[model samples]
Target chain A: MATAVVARPVSRTQTRSREEEVLVWPDLVFIEFIAAMLFTITLFLLSFLVNAPLLDQANADVTPNPSKAPWYLLNLQELLLHMNAAMAGVIIPTIWLVIMGAFPYFDREQHGQGVWFGTEKAVRLTIVSAVVGFVGTWFLILWDSGKIAFFLHGWFGLSGGDSLRFLENVRSVQTQLPWPEWSRNITYSPVNIVIIGEDFQHLDFPAWLVEQGIPTMAMVGMSAMLIFSLWRVGWVVTRRDALIVLFSAFVAAYGVLTLTGTAFRGQGQELVFPWELKVSEGIPGQE
Target chain B: MTQMQPSAGAAARRIEHARQAEARKLSRRSFLRVSVFAGLTLSVGAMAAGFLGFFNLRKPTGFGGVITVVPARVPKAGEEPSRISEGKFWLSNLAGAQGDVAGVGGTGGILALYWKCPHLGCTVPWNPAFNGAAVNFPGIVGWFRCPCHGSTYSRAGIRVYGPAPRPMDTMAVSVNSDKSLNVNTGVITSGGPDNPLRAKPYSG
Candidate 1:
């Protein structure tokens, strides 16, 4: 008996030679070098066209009316206008960074790798998130600035004095929550409540708490509501899609806040038209 | 059958060796590529970080350090505050009674007042219009006026009018052996009802 060897058949597609092959040296490196050169040229042109203005030397005694943080940190500074400084400056940023870092773990899919707006669903989610963030932040800023609040107050015929009296009375109460006399009495201490507490203290802690709490609650509640809507609408089928929506929202909100802080805030951190801003007496570098 | 089993076992061992050799070669190539990329990234990152760090380096002479404002001879008793641009402050020569209230030393005390307004930190300038000759201030001469807000300070750096919560802040002043005024910008004393005058008498 004679032994015979068998061979597997090759398909025409497999046999065809590749027309293009990507190599890192010239393909990727050249593009990178060109991009870097263009960026440098742009920066050089900007330096010549725009002169960086130096304000009068730092004077500790005379702080500018609307003291502002650096440009990158303006988002937090803008948040400071609506909420507690610790929450805006520390808590929010820390949470954002941690979430961003953990995004990769949540989005473990190999599908749609290295593609912008990877899927049609992703693009829609991003657009929806961005719109939600932009409109929400814009409304919050206007509301916190007393622009909308005062308008509605007048429109509703609510007397400013009555509103202030109500707030004062609520603040004077010993407990964190105004209702139930027993809760107030239980928490009350003669030395701490009357002296060290917000009752007689120079700084109005109760007023600050109420002022800061409303905006904080609104921000958190709205974000939670958005996520819940996405889940209920079935737009967020996967963790990757959910992350895409959240990341886009965060980016949009950050951009809006930075723009607002840089151009909108004027004397006393009050909202003003960019053209009407009196930079001479306001924040440094604005002038 | 026993002889055929040994031959089959040897063939299997030989095939495993070839596969292990191929894997080693592939891994070696990948390791080199990864290391090279990492090195490039790290060097670029380090250079960029170094460039950015340069901007944060501060000089030893400015805001937080001591600066010599002016010589003692420039400011005369009951005269206007001599503005020193370099030190960003005003040097005033007050009478002994005013100095006593200001907490300064010397026959006629010397006080260094920060040019910044106590209200909102705007630069305050001595307005000659509000001097004794002017009727607006009523017997006040060489009063400091803030351009931002209408906070007015008397010659002694005391807040006399407007929304200023307290008097103008003072810096520690020392007289050198050469009689030049050395203003310690580092030590800032807040002006309030309890300590309205925070003047450090020039010690020669």
Candidate 2:
């Protein structure tokens, strides 16, 4: 027995492998339960702070000043103010969300992984385009609103002093314009049949036209840029096709927004020209 | 049996197998033993609190009562009634006559309906321009429209159009002898299409 004594040596790799611990299924469930409970309690507390029905009664005839929806819906309402409610409030949003949900299926790749851009370069580019489109839209709106204020207050006699004060007061509620007898007389005349509504039919346009030409051109330019960007992000098949579809879509959308601003906002007509300009920038017109 | 020689790998495998066997033999009796102890402790705590009537204040109990408002009559055929407010509620008395029985209350042919929609519980507004700006209904006939999902209801609390599943909720009303209105703030019964007081379908 004392003749032969042999011992096998331990390997460092084996020891290390044994030490590694992988999380099991139960651990994940516990974590998920904790997260859900925290989230629910947080929402319950926030509801109290915000005045909860959390509820309120809705009255349509007496529209609230700044007749805006809840904050999340404000974006949609804002769009409705510029574009047709059907388009801005319903169609575009539905299409946008559908397209977003479909993104993972169409671009199946594993390159970028956990990063914000995901794995596909094309997918990242598309994301950037969406961000740019959203931010561009908001930027254009602010620009248009500023330009509108300038043109209406400075160029057109319809918007200075008391008119602006009146406009501000009526911005949230539906307010009728204090149309002069002369304006009313011209409303029935056929000179501006293109502007059918009683409010826009009598707008004093020449006073604000020359300066407005710039914003008008800017609108066309911005619209062109949107087309180009959308095309670059794969909306169009070819350059020529991109040019045709984008220009057509922009014109049609702009026309719709302009019409909305013209009719719905008749009570606040002095702001019509600028309103159209803002409509060109994508703000929805509302009463 | 030949030499009784042992390998390190064999020894390690034997130890792991024994550990697994020990784990598999765990019994439901052991689990019950622990859970029963925990449950008993919780029950004891609850019983102690029960003995205390608990220092917690009892929730106040009361019967429903009326919230009153001045009388509002249907407006003259042409003029729209001014919007009236009673405490926390907003009243659009399109029927122009301002009578005494307006608040939570007694009736003078006054048709009062809560503005809140029964579907998803949103406040519905009367869009005079809903049937389009050209529609002649004006203020008298209009549906309560929910801005949230386009739920529409008639002034008589009936679901005329849109996604509303039932008629709007109605507050109890009582008109007193002094022409004052007493609206009992309780008794909100909202369900299905049938309403007790409505005479006919609201044309709006």
Candidate 3:
């Protein structure tokens, strides 16, 4: 976790003497009294300036466009866009929680306990992972939304974005798949599977491939890729370093997802600029 | 003589006697602390139970009750779907839908699909015209397309694409002797797996 970088309290207790010892009655109590008075005054002024507004009455019909989860859950909501709802909404979060719970057991090195960063390389790793995680997640979201395709097509007149129609404009716009000819032929060819756009929806194999196979493989593959790259770079030699990278990445991803879900997502959960966001009140004409 | 086991009354009296003996040791501060904690626990426990019972999925009544539709309103196997906004369902027949979608329900029957998108409960509308260019689905004219998460479903309510967990939910439809359907919105079953089960045929 990134520790709050507020002012560190002076460790006067380390060199304590009876001469410096203060009584709890007037000395400590007076300071506390002043603090309490200051807080009370600040709160009074704040409340006077800011008014709490009541929201619209909850309605069952006509879903509010861009219906968002609470801020804490926006990450999961954003994840729900990229893959299967079960994997995105349920299984992934559950698995993540379990792994985090078991993280202490995996990293038993006694050096890091009770400290914000225990290892010598921790500060460097945190910054690197944070940047990589935040940027990588933002990039992936854009790529999935086909904004990258839109840009490539706009800039270079590149014409491979049509291959992304696998989901029929379901989760993304037309993706410019500038992949080689062999991959294209293999991809769009009538497969006995669900991931191949329209032809395979009737079959069971394709459904599993789309809903289960791809998500699981993508998660595993990405993590493996990260670890492998880190190992090769000599950045992650120990399990502790690897875990720190993973944790830092996770935190960074969580933050980026929250930001994306909050700001970047426009109507219909489409990726758009923050200014483009319009809350469709589901009022017939206005919508 | 062996000691006789205490009777219910005797046991209660003995517990009362023990309580009184223990009560003698309780100072006012400890007594107040114990009583306050006990009161808080009781209120919190009652509230938790109240919340569970309040939100429990009982029969969806009022707007979500059984909706009966005459035979004429039910769409043909490949026609435009009839929407019941009040009932939150689309009445469509999937028997003769083009493409591989005809595989559902064999000869097909009248399917009462709950309009709520299985992904996040946005009402899905049926596309009136087939647009081959609008994605990969060959014939999407009579398909249910969700605008919320872009989850599209075949006429049979199977998840064609998007992040929908499964097929759109189906309300139980009972065909009557006169060819009318009594669709119970209260009883909802998942589309189940990738391929949705066939609905009961209204007529040949």
Candidate 4:
């Protein structure tokens, strides 16, 4: 059993004073309420100022040369412009979120005590990582554009100069049929994907089945397996929470995908269908 | 005597230790409050700087609003000039006008064309300036090319290549009775095969 002990003064005994402390809750509430209202009003004004630009109407028949996505998505669209779609669209966003969520877990530190950088080595590393991520992505995009232009001309035989000529020739000349007919069967076209089974498409599908499908399934399976590991992590450092991190990551990823499609892909532009091309040209020899 | 002295010393040490622990707890609390405020300030500052840098990138340059072109005297039937580059402004003749000049019941003869790439707002410079080497592009020459991004347009300003999403816009032209070309500021928008500005032989 523990006994209560009173402390005696080192010198002569001195009398102590007692005071009552009162918290001003009303004042705190008023300040908080004001702040929240001001924030809402500011955001409303800001949203009103940011008017979005609309492109010309979407037509399936007339494809615009070098069709571009909206400005907000220029970076991602630039990625799509240079790299493969799947890599730019899905894999990059997933990687970004995974790294961000796993950060504090990987960097456990007792040192950073009260400083914002918290004498914690992990906190400092996070700041550094964020800077690196931003600068690295910007530099990577700049380098990609210049390097990509070469491939456009050298390998693809598609120069910004030559593509116009190619389209005109392809449009006018008929060697049994137009180039679109020939390209229609080549099978990267979405028309084939919805119409025919995966096996029926002309491209290498067995490889897509093994490489893409299997890995995607494995990734989902691995996430399920990690639940126990994640639970254990959350159990420690009672202050550590997982729901906010996981949910935030999911929302970020979903936002990126939605923004990518909305900002980059034109809604009504269909690459398939030749009938739409029959608009209003003159009959040859009539003039 | 020895046991009494040791007990007395232990009591003194415990009192000192308790006082120090209380002091440490208070300091840690103060430090935490300051740190949170500082971290928030830094994060906000960084985000603001990032957005500012992204928004201020360089804008593109464009040419004068209007460009005009003139075809030769009387072109033979079915004969189109491969290139039209000489005087006031660079223009590529898109299509020949039908009918006779002075004869009644004639639809009037005036070359129909315009000179601007509807995409990216860049001037579609006529490439006829390039000699036969650049011409006869695979036995057939294209009309205009964009120096900025290599967008090519036919004599009709139809976007054939590069990043332009639509055909070139047409300058409104009024051929005076004297046969001199007068171009208006208005540009006729052309797109697809049905675009009213499309030239003959190319319209679907």
Candidate 5:
């Protein structure tokens, strides 16, 4: 016996009608217009309230006590105080930009499109990452600024003559490792090393590495841990979820750094209360 | 039956041969397309370079640009260095004896030094403490001290001590007809064995 197959025609209009979209003219255009107006008003208000600083005519002879970069670049300048200039100014930012560019390629899912914190799990992850970034960056700024370290030292009664001498000795000398000469030599190599002191006379490369690496590792490691934990716990089942956590963390870190640089840094680029800051001088009426 | 089988096998071979020929044609077309794209990219890059040159697009003013430090904010002789923000340098009016000591030649002797420290490029500030009796360089009236590093420079911008490889860099200084100071920051003389005072100082 032979069997015949039957073919039915499908309607093109029905399939075409499934696509739902709002008109760009009124829907998107009106929203854009409102956003532009809001932005302009905010800018006008800011300009009215604050005047641009104009310092005394360019004197080639004296530099201000703590010369700072423009506000937008202050984040990198803040980073410069803690880490190697090359890493702070170039490497880290370049890596972040590359990662941001590659994000779309890594997350190809369309389910989360046009949605803020697309899933419940993504919202939780973002909040956690943001908290981690904020606390981590703040801790680093305080520790590196010597506020916390000196406070702890003084609290522990280590500021006295003998205790201070012991602390100085501990800082000056490198701890001897039981490892072989080759291993020790490899460890001692100045790859991500810096020598900082009154004259950079000390050869404390390991300490410098550890000091600079803490904040960097904390930021990166916390984000990685969040992704890993989310994956293991089945919270982040997709690449988009992982990227959401990472990007949220990055935004938080950027905001924290900018805030710290703008408000916390004072004369000599030292950490100070916002009210105590004396760096902003030469504004028309501020003087 | 054998003849029919032979004909079927020949047809199969013909189909295979045709498929291979088609693949070769497709590959050749793709290669041509790639070469055209590469050529187009190179031409566009060349055009961009030519356009930039034609438009005289140049880098923004930096250390090497000649800048006018106006109003002649010259420090009194034996006074502290005057900070010139536009030029990003310090202009010091050295005493005649100090200018002679540094071999800097001028009737109204002045020296313009880049604010950057030679060791790590940190801004060096003049510390009045170095002139006090308690300091090691008590005889020196004032000295440049690097806050980042303990490098010190004498009144003449010579490296007195510390990790700084050499003395501070000096720029060419000349007085304009209007009595303004014209500093050729572009022509930087490195501090080494070269005489620091060789640049003609601005006299107004």
Candidate 6:
């Protein structure tokens, strides 16, 4: 602290001119200081009331069942279910980050600098998009659970008709079931979205297309479809308005995936009620 | 040095010339600084190169190379898989006659599955009780289940369930005269369309 000195004669502190310029120290930094103090006090009080969501001391041998990423990364962990590890854990996230990083360059709107929503329509669209995102993602999770179909038949004694066959029959699900739970039916019928009535019933699609490509495509396709549908309904007029829906949906989806990964996931990463979560993969010989 | 007072412009020109001369000549302090920087860079570069040169170093042959697993440690047909922690593999003796799995031969001999799951490298543990309703395959209990993403595989190391792209990778095996199993950890093969043959015919 004692090292603070006027090293230069023309330092920021020795400003001679007083143009209508906002100074950083008292104006911005003071606000930040007050905000930081408020945050620290709030956290202190919260810590007294609530326990930190950290695990017990880690062990080398016993791996926790459904070993989860931190809440922030759990969304990407959720992505692991439907794609190759390289694709899910790396490529897609990298692409997303690049897209998000480039967003400022693409989105150069002059207005609505300080406002939450650009327009009243944007506000309504944001809420609607959020709801759509939450429900749609929830529906997708349920669809992929391999449980919805199992439950409909197992619990309700329903045949394929009475079951949630619709989820299973989603052309992508029917075609590109990537996971082991998706059954070992993929190998027998390699890949290539499959156009019949020709000698070559299949086209070589670089294995990943079957594993990650379809699901990733579906995710992008669904978002595109949502945007297109919303646009057709006249709710979205400008590019920013459309972007509002997309961003809102993305944020809501991020929240939903995090919640799902944290709470609903169980042993073997299966979807289970929070109550049913048995922590470890279960020590090998103990069982 | 001139005794008479020089003009201002002439003095300034001389000073400029002197400054240029001063800039060109390397001082002892600057020389020391440069030598120190060079030494630091060379040593650091050498250390970094040494670190990377580890890959160029010949891989030692024994545990990581051709591992001659103990003969008695191998599992019998239709029994629990034997885990060779040192070799990073599991030896499963599948009984093909039970019709539990497809692609296995009639005898369903020993299959050495690399313990690392294809999903994300979490070591898959064999769950004997992971059977009946738990797995898609009915009546078949023994399975290699990856805890990471729940990528499960058959006793024959076939990708049965989970997010694994392919079946558990298998290492090349050759039997010795004394019946000691020699698993070449180096000679790896994917248990997919590339190499249809998964297991070597071993009673163990």
TM per candidate: 0.42, 0.33, 0.54, 0.28, 0.44, 0.65
Local distance difference test scores for all models: 0.63, 0.43, 0.69, 0.40, 0.63, 0.69
Q: What are the chain A TM-scores for all the models, listed individually?
A: 0.62, 0.33, 0.65, 0.29, 0.61, 0.63
* Model 5 lDDT, full chain set: 0.63
lDDT per residue (tens digit) for residues A102-179 in model 4: 857765544543345332233333343344334444333322222234334457765555333322221112111224
Off by over 4 Å in 1: A1-56, A153-216, A282-287, B1-204
Q: Please report how far candidate 6 places residue A16 from its true position, in Å.
A: 19
- Per-residue C-alpha lDDT of model 6 across residues A1-287, encoded as one tens digit per residue: 58876667664665556776657677778889999999999999999999777553343335556677887888888867756777878898788788778766677777775577876588888998999889988877765655555666568866554233334322223323333533433344344343331223332344445466667876788788888988898988777777788889988988998888888887667678999977664454553
Residue runs of model 4 more than 4 Å from their true location after superposition = A1-287, B1-90, B94-115, B129-137, B193-204
Give every collision pair in model 1: A62-B121, A63-B121, B105-B201
Model 2: per-residue Cα lDDT over B171-195, one tens digit each:
5555566555555545555533333
Which model, 2 or 3, shows the larger TM-score? 3
* Pairwise TM-score winner, candidates 4 and 5: 5
Locate the minimum summed-lDDT window of 10 residues in model 5 chain A: A168-177
Candidate 5, residue B136: the lDDT equals: 23
How far in Å is the alpha carbon of A284 misplaced in model 6?
5.1
lDDT of 3 by residue, A1-287 (tens): 99988998886748778889777677878899999999999999999998656333344556666677787888888888778776888899999999999988998878767677667677877888888888888877776665665566557866453454443232322122233434323443454564523344243444455566666776667666777787788877777888888888889989999999888876656677899888766543344
TM-score of 5: 0.44
User: In model 4, what lDDT does residue A274 have?
Assistant: 35
Candidate 1, A162-259: lDDT as tens digits: 22422221111211134443432343334554532124323334434443455567767777788789979988778777778888888899999999
Task: Mark the regions of model 3 whose C-alpha exceeds 4 Å error after superposition.
Answer: A1-59, A84-86, A111-123, A143-205, A283-287, B1-83, B91-112, B120-150, B154-158, B170-204
lDDT (Cα, 0-100) at A75 in candidate 4: 49
lDDT of 3 at A114: 65
TM-score of 3: 0.54
Calculate DockQ per candidate and list them: 0.04, 0.03, 0.23, 0.02, 0.05, 0.25
